[model samples]
Target: MKYISKNIVFSVLVLSFFGISSLNAQNDNSKIEQLIEKKRNYNQTEVKSKGYIIQLYNGNETKAYAVQQKFDEMFPAYTSKMKVDLPDWKVQIINFKTRLAADRALNLFREEFVGANIPKS
Candidate 1:
């Protein structure tokens, strides 16, 4: 009887330890998930600020035109003309309300241009 009680006590201790560890692990996971969601919301809000600019480029005029055409079709009335800071011949499209909006428009253009580059709008 003494030996049986000792064994049961040992088993209970081990189970208790594991249960406590599992609870801690679940709390940690919840905290991590909350932090991730907060970060995502913050990043999205930062990019969604209106009055942002975007720059896009391509070496070929036909390629540039193709990208522009795609943007026109996908995001009607979203594209606007802007000039690069320097006097380079490359034309810029701009006039987006938010960085996220610019990104959405640029992504649409990228599908067509393939190699064309776009800066944050």
Candidate 2:
């Protein structure tokens, strides 16, 4: 019947679409893996190299999160860490591959705090 043929054709088209999408998804994932392999490897020594240190209020995760969000927006490739001490929280951003990159992030973060913040190598 015409109805049966039409239904079969529609089902075949949907199945084909899903099949093609799955192959495309796999290809995209492979490209991402290759790029990750190419990115710089971060180690403890590099982490200690040079960075920017900003002290936030104790238990003030809200501000840290906000600052992190802003920082990530400007320097999506940078790394950061948060340390807690007796009555204060310290946030440091480091492992920058170049001074220019580090300086750029420091300038952007200055939108929140300004002073002797960034530590240069």
Candidate 3:
């Protein structure tokens, strides 16, 4: 009878330990899920508007197109764009995501395009 009682007490203690550990695990999972949801909401509302561009030419439309064409031929890997800012038609290499990337491209461009520069923003 004493052995049976001792076995029962030990069984209860082991079961209670596992039960408490499981409850703590479930609580940890809930906290982790809440953190993930908050991160998702933050990402959804974030607006990314930082980057750099190198302007190759700023002149008339005819010269802008000519510069863009020449730039396209020289640096086929990079994408070029033209923008009309009032009196000047600007030819630019768009979407350099970092200053280092823009500077590297600018160095290469200066070898061929004398006017290649990153415009002040």
- Candidate achieving the largest TM-score: 3
Give the lDDT ranking, best first: 3, 1, 2
Clashes of each: 2, 0, 0
Clash pairs for candidate 2: none
- Which sequence of candidate numbers ranks them by TM-score, best first? 3, 1, 2
Worst 10 residues of 1 by lDDT: 82-91
Give lDDT per model, in order: 0.64, 0.63, 0.91
Judging by lDDT against the true structure, name the best candidate. Answer: 3
Q: 102 in model 3: Cα distance from truth in Å?
A: 0.3
lDDT of 3 by residue, 29-102 (tens): 99999999998897668645478899999999998899999989988999999999989999999998867799
Instruction: Name every residue pair that clashes in candidate 3.
Output: none
Better of 2 and 3 by TM-score: 3
Which ranges in model 2 have alpha carbons more than 4 Å from their true place?
41-113, 116-121
Give the per-residue lDDT digits (tens) of candidate 2, residues 1-121: 9999999999999999999999999999999988776664544335655434433222466676666666667657666677666465556675656666667666776775564165433
**Model 3 misplacement above 4 A:** 1-49
